[model samples]
Target: MANIVSYLAREQRTFEEEPFNMVDGLVMATLAYLRYERYDRLPARPSEPFRLHDVLALASWRDLLAGSWMRDAADSRSFLRALMASRRYRDAFVSFYVSESSDAVEKQFSAITLTVGDGCVYLAFRGTDGSLAGWKEDFNLCFMDVTPSQQAAVAYVSGVASALPGRIVLTGHSKGGNLAQYAALCVASDVYGRITRVCNYDGPSFLGDPSPRVGDPTYRAMLFKAVPESSLFGMILEDGSDYHVVQSSAMLIFQHEPFSWLVSDGDFLYRDGLTRTALWADGTLDGWLKTRTPEQRAQFIDTIYDFVAASGVKTAADLHRNFGSIVMSVASSTAKLDPETRAFILDTFKALVGVVGRETAKSIDPRTRIRLPRRRESYDGSRPADFARSLRPAADGSQLAEAGKPSHAEPDGLQLAGAGGPCPAKADGVHPAKADDLRLGECGASLPVPCPSAPSPEASPAACGGVLDKD
Candidate 1:
């Protein structure tokens, strides 16, 4: 079925001609997921706004989008190539960009600005990447009141809006969409009023009821949200706000992908409401969440994160790759946790298992589940391994990165060192914190301040990166 990529390839209308619609927003959101941090040809904080044509002029779509999306890498790259070439966005200015990722802290946030010369600028916030996918986001959000990413979103918009005098529009896919609305609600009144619209495509909602904080008529009038008929990500902890339903080409959990959302005539194929299975899944999630207090949920996520960190598995794919080892590692670590904490974590998974039993579960990626020997490494010469080798953990478990290098890892196997890439020798004395700063320079934080720090090493620099994929 036709999707956003198809729309980009087919649509020639400019913002002046047809106006910016949800389809355009989705394309921008997907482009926002592109990891510009990897290319040295482009500065992280460009002094002048970078035009879409400039990006297309530098690299082929494949190099620009290598290792961007965890799920729809090919489709996303295609969408990007078409976007950079399309008359609609070729002249658009993309600036004030920042992207950060830290396994040390379990959050990934990034945003970019798109100026289409239409008196409006789009603040495209990134959603989750491969590392922080559907399940990780669901678990981590249980305890966060306002994540560093959300705060950064507020600050990011505030900073950009203060600098640029155009009408503001906030949009994102997945968690990014959620941030667009959240930032709209929380940003200062003047900036909030400047925001003409906020588009949320399949992004989850906040931890608590946000209605009390939502006081602006501007916000209410500008909000636009859509979810797939069988969404799992969008419905999680939904705020009971109205949203349109769109038919999807994917099934059940995977319907969270905007690439799968059916598009026709520049709009989604509308549905009346979520599918019955989606309602059940949403109810199941709500029930499980209610069963645990915020504190319990927080503790449970912490416990799991602590376990994974201790296990020395860099990504979730690491756990699945050597199931026996992970099982043993988890067993050993489970004994360290207090009985209450262990029980809580177990109960949460127990509920998830129950939900899965009602419907068959599919693995995220089959290749990630298996280990490839160094000799067996394979790729089209561009993918996760190149990025992974750049950010591979140092002797002390800190990620050392070079500026403008794709020094990041996908929790899925693509980031595995075996993906056929040689790590460049590090300049002497690359501290994790310092390396983080360099990487941050390659991928700025986009905010005036660091994203909220998770509890950890006293010196942990606030981490941020160009996070890809919300689901």
Candidate 2:
């Protein structure tokens, strides 16, 4: 009966056409969470196969895309209305990975809410896939690889540019920003002229020293980058896009959801406290394993792969939940670990959680102690770590950044970091407070600023060659 219910929910929600939106995001998030929570309670052996959550999540996500979320003029009030309208956002996101193709195996993913504002659509696929399969996967609201995803994104926006008969705007979460930039690059001469700007929220680092040009030059000309003060994921990318660094209350750095910026009725204003801890445990775990004898790192990765392979869960959500449980056991020191391996296991687990907790904090409600909005006077865009580092902690544990730092004017506004790669765009211009900016951190905030703008790749500073900085 439970299986039937799950099947029906997934089937009823499948996306077969266009017009996706936040309703899809809600469904995907729901399925991902549900499948993650229950993967372990099912059969543990392949022969006795446990139900897969990936398929279900994918189905729900696709269904959301079939709606009209991607149309233009979409706003936060409408987005939230859509989210609240659904009962299962997490599940839909989790189940988005049930691909039957061999080609899409290696790619990062996201839901793209185009400027058209139909709502939203999950754009998932690997960058490595060739053009044929790539073209088939509805570049509009489907998964894709890095290269192909960029291509499709460009086409979508170029179409918008052509159709609008004027300038077009593009933005996305995570890899979506990368795609947006790629689209800007790919836009045709006439179409490119119509694109106004691009915004990327903490997307991954762009690959290549002589960065590969994927979209139109005009498109690249109008790109911007935004991230949380203590960003983890987006910081890995380069410093080319227009940048903005958001202040957040959620601890564990990455949790800075731009949407959380506090807003009052019409004005997006905020007042909250934010803090950062090294997540020392997170810092050393994986890298330590990698640093171990090369053979040890290889062995560690293999061991984890084997463990998951043996766990019977077959979907993305299932894998996440199962791996999470396994990690939790490692963190709690509750698993029956070997005498020689226990210390390593716990250390790795702690590090993993701290890192994920920081990133996940922006959207997921992992229990947190503090939350703050960016002070209008404090809107000088310094990195959060820099912000925290500048100030001493009060006895009450509040951070005191640059005393009498009477808020300087927000620089050309935007973007962070150390520990990872070179922290991009330190202080770019930040506009008036945004309503969404007050509630969500950078990753989710929708500031009412000019569309994104970017520096030329040829002009972008080279990756400090071979030295990936830490967060």
Candidate 3:
């Protein structure tokens, strides 16, 4: 299926010919918000708004493409360049009031406003940037009533609303989406009245109690939510707002990329509902989160952030570049944790793994039952490779067949057996299964490789491109 880039290339109609839709708003919001990072070099907000065409004319598209943010800054720039050349969006957006803040102790907030078409203003909030502070605020959403960025968004929206003359449309991707919803709800009655729509493009939901105004029927009606079928970030703490599940070309968590979302004739390809895998993940995560006390949740967040901060990497890009050294630093820091804290961390992780394993095992065919060898009674906090080695049978004892080796046959199919099982080798001498196919644990149930981190809500496939098939 074609995505936004291909959609833009195919459609040549202007706003007058075809009015703006959610997809159009989303593309504009993405471009307007992510490009603010480039404006850091500017002295301040210009007295007059700069049309996208004019901005691209004066600025170096090459240099803008070089600076990285958490999201797809390069692709967003590309889309802007494409939009500037197109009849559809060439004169549609004029950007103004770009600002960004970074406070290690509080949180990070960044936003920009664009006047789209003729009379409507779109306030686009930048989602979590590469800044560690920005990500920390994302975690804070679980506990806090209002994140620092949310507060800033409220103020920004109110101030901008006073100065602008036209109706408003608030929109954002990822954390920016959350901020857009929050700002729209918190704006004064007059400003709120002027809001045409509040579009949340796979933004997270509020966990704790939100403002009473958020529940107002009229306000809720103004909100529009959409998520990809295999969403993770969008499902977190999400409820109330009816969310549209859209088909995405990117796999698994990478579906968070707006560019991966399939577009047809200037609109997204809507799905019936979330994928079964997404539903299972949401249920599993919600259950796990409930098991943790508020204090435990806080501790876990703090501990993880502490480890990340110790590496002295301020941005995700920096961490990506020096991943090896950062990982080593994290390992060293992990070793310094008190025994009790260490135990708590390990036990929590173990429980989470057990949940995933059990859930995965349920999905396998019962007739093809494959049993794993029993695990040892105790587990030290050693490396995974060391633990695997320790599980190996004694030299004199019966040995488990290697991963690809055929061990035994059941009535239904080949069953992997424990030590002393027959090792029937194929003519090629290679095992039937590859190492990657072998699942860890006592049930021999397969599971997808755990993602290193939650995909950025607003990340573009072009920014961090890869594919992982769903299990």
Candidate 4:
């Protein structure tokens, strides 16, 4: 039942008393998601560092500015209120807030520096916001090593490191976590030497070799990577840094939201490693990425971006306003893609599903049965059903939440948790050639599978049921 809000509210100990730990790192990283730039009282670039208490005194949850654009805006506003009222963080200070969203370069970057108790400094980079541009940057990470955001992060860390004197920690959730690590290594030696830790909370790793910016051999010691047991975005591409899994209360992709992570007396509930499904997913994804050349990645990614752009929606707010129009725009756009690009999308999806299906069969107990929800064919052939409405299993009971609107704090897709009776044998004249033809998602029962947008089977677990079902 405990989360960061409750933990901080009850916490009387200062940073000096308790010292910084995984929990503190997670907390700071989560705070980075707040639209700090929109809060005018917080110091911006070239401005001297401002005390956290002073800023909180002037700012209210009403002016936090997450309400219009951020996913789960209400929860985020409440979280900020908790932080502002916390006794533990009164000594913390903030400065050098920067945020940029540019469609021309397909980049969305934001970072803030928090100097706490004159001892520890956190350079917190934000992950994807509601912007489609933000999501595109995440896609860019799949092919490129150093994103524009990463470069900005490096500069941000270097610019503020000397001015803010402390034992520095580069920290963030999602792509922000990726940025933190990237900034740590890429900064000058003086700045790198001051960094005591780099906390990456469920961030993706580089697809290509990041050149000329490697830190000293000590970076491995500085790393503290934690991902949920059923991580998807965190497992993208290939990662060499060791990471441990943490238990999450929520299922599947929603686990990427740090708020869903389960906490104990003073720390996160730890697991040995990723779940069987996650391991299979990461391996499958790495294999899939390794097969494609960088050129192919760029070409295919551009095609996908085109579809998103065609929707004419910019941010999560826009998504909420015009869901129907956006869907229509995306569907029409998909049909206009060159034949080769269309083939690539379909061929790639089939191959990935085949691999996941084979893995599921091998990994699970064939005797067990999993009842999956039926698939309706409303998706544009290019769009997957995984991004649609989901009936989430909440703590109290079932609740409805929209999928693929952007995550609460990271570069993760919204989860589509559809649990129901059984699949219809016929395709409803919508999707003629389905993955069910390949026997893609079942153990023994012949359920007609409706395809979900799974990079691996793990991405959309509820829709593609069988081996990954918890019950």
Candidate 5:
């Protein structure tokens, strides 16, 4: 049963399937809650009183600092714990991870291996193959969001590019891809120049072009995004990257898996999709956001920041454990806040859930007009480890191991995988749909997992249920 579940889990992520960002979001929301709860538990006393606004400020700063300073998983967790402890308001909670008896606070790194290069650093969060047994405890607790990671990556690149002027490449799977592109746009020229390519296997799209920092031209040159043809998150927003929609043969949900796209050939196969629907949704949302008198967006940002900071949790893991209770508290308090802001938060929450639910449904069975073979499973049988090994050179291009040349690389070619079931492709190009249009259950039987912070449906196949059940 465990093996079957694992196989299905792997199948769900095959290149043909559309992936959900549920886990990443959950982690972020959980972290927010952790910070908030810890803040409240601190002993009443001392240098400063707890301020909801301070929590907001902390959240804002954390969002801005996610990938900055290049701290791998371990250092990040420790620094955050300490920062929270010292904030006066959280002084009593300062030693949560520390013991007075111990002179030094030991920091723990993720089970994944790290490869640091001259200008780039690569972090491989130990996955199934890695020796990080039980290390993946809370990975699926949240979905990825580029804003935080991009902010950090940009900061990291800015410093590196200034120190060494040359070509640079930023890359990551899922959330990392978004960060790579985001950092490229956020940094200064010297920093961006060092960035030659930004590879995002499948990251959520930007709200639109990044808030142009040093004008628009510089933002356009460095993006190289790719997604499996049936990708869910990859098609979320438009960043203007002519995304290579890979032709995939994977029978199941393929969008979530990266290896599913690796062909025997060294190159990926792709086909264009009717992106108009997706484009429409992107433009609509992005426009609505951008047109918001800066004041409106500011207010919106403030409201969420405040809401999360108020909870005082640290990592996503902390929040997920207690999100239901917290949500109830927020719902109870909503009546006390300004009616307009309260309505906005409630509406936004609904909208977010509806969007994911709807997309997951549609992606699972998009009346697909096209299907193509992405790669043969053989590539993965013996070569996947080797493939990752070659690319494993840290994000900075420092070689981690010698690239084992393949016995024979497959030639790149497109193969049509017959469409399954019903639901013909819509004639309209794949433009973005409105949040309302994205309502789930209107079409599909089951919605993909909702937000990471929310519990998985009780009925979800329990194959690997244990994987996330305890965490």
Candidate 6:
């Protein structure tokens, strides 16, 4: 099925002709006007709302696209180019009240208001950007009751609703969706009464119980949550309001991309239910999270944020590009954690692994029981030939291959991969033995043999020993 861009290009009918649908929700959510570095450059709100043509007339679309942190400039450009040219959205949708803020100590929030047709107004909240602080706030939601972004959303919604006279339709993608729901709930009864629908497109769930106002029949009836078949972010914490599963062309975590969502005839192609992969992940995450106390969860969240911050990258894209360095930073931070906190982190990781292992085991055939082989003492790390001799066939009908050998080759001896001589240096310039020590420490595994402080030149090739030998 065609995606949103294709739908916008092909569909000619306006809101006046076809009426508002999920397709319109997707279009509003895709707006990157909040990412514009200079909001002052744009036309004023309400009194001088900018039409799609007017915004494009400013010749600042390229600058605005470049300023976006969450989406690629090309994608943003393509979407806007399609939007401005479309008969469906170009004339009907006009933007106003754009706001954005990034306060690491407080909150990261951005939103915009759009006038759709004559009587309806669409409040579009931007989702998490590339800011590390924004992501941290999202993780904080796992423990905290109300985030700063949610509070800002409430204030923005209330202020905008009072000033504008129309049937309000709240909409957002990702964290924006979460804000939309929270703001809708926090508004006064009269303000809430003006809201016709609250469309949450793959938004996450609140940590604790929702406000009593959300439980009111009138408010609950206005909620509309839609998620992709293999949703990850949308399935976090809880599945609030009965969610509609939409088909997506992307797989796994990439399904979170709204562009991947399948659209047909200006509406999302509905799926019967969430995909099995989504359910499995949701269940596994929920199960692992249940094993941790509230304090533990908070600590875990803090530790993650601390590590990310320690990397000195402000955006997720930068962090991902420098992942190797970030990992090293994380390892250094892990080493510095207090004994108790370190143990808690390790134990929490082990529990998560156990959950995944159990689920994996359940999916395997009953007749083929799986077990890890016991460590061997005779395996000498120094001798490549002797290490290969200790190899055995696994239950999966595969034999361990010698290091640096072809996958089909039989194990000949214990030798570090890419290590040509007795004492091979790892890619990081550290000795293989020392590198193994760091790996073992990171995994909380006891070193079977003490690692040498330095590589010994005089040591015999047959006398070498380490985790590689035992493996």
TM-score of each model, paired residue for residue: 0.71, 0.38, 0.73, 0.72, 0.40, 0.74
For residues 103-143, write the lDDT of model 3, one tens digit per residue.
55657776676654545567888777667788888987755
Q: Which residue ranges in model 2 land beyond 4 Å of their true spot?
A: 1-79, 82-104, 107-148, 158-165, 186-190, 209-221, 238-242, 253-258, 263-310, 314-316, 324-471
Candidate closer to the true structure by TM-score (higher is better), 1 or 4:
4
Which stretches of model 1 miss by more than 4 angstroms?
Answer: 44-47, 60-63, 70-72, 132-138, 210-216, 336-340, 347-471
> On residues 1-471, what C-alpha lDDT tens digit does candidate 6 reach at each position?
588888878887866666677777777876733454343456533434566566665656555554344246335666767877888776654444545556456367877777645456778888887777788888877667678788778777776665556567788899999988888777666766667777788889775544666567766666778899988888887533588899988889888888888988767899988765776677666667667765688898788778878778787788889999998888789889999988888888899998765444333333321222235424556765655543544434544443343344222322333445222111121111100111000111111221122221222111211011111
lDDT, candidate 4, 219-277, per-residue tens = 76667788999998887753445787899877888788887787777788989777767
What RMSD does model 4 have? 17.0
**Tens digit of per-residue lDDT, candidate 2, span 233-339:** 55442433345554444455424333332222222222231123322222323233233443444444444544544455343445455777756543444355585
How much is the lDDT of residue 175 in candidate 5? 49
Where does the lowest 10-residue lDDT sum fall in candidate 1?
434-443
lDDT for model 3: 0.64
1 versus 2: better lDDT goes to:
1
Candidate 2 worst ten-residue window by lDDT: 459-468
On residues 292-348, what C-alpha lDDT tens digit does candidate 5 reach at each position?
A: 433455465555545544666443444567789767766666777888878876766
Model 4 / residue 257 / CA error / Å? 1.4
Error of 6 at 221 (Å): 3.0
Error of 5 at 293 (Å): 6.1
**Model 4 pairs in collision:** none
Off by over 4 Å in 4: 42-45, 60-62, 65-78, 209-217, 316-328, 366-471
Mind sharing the TM-score for model 5? 0.40
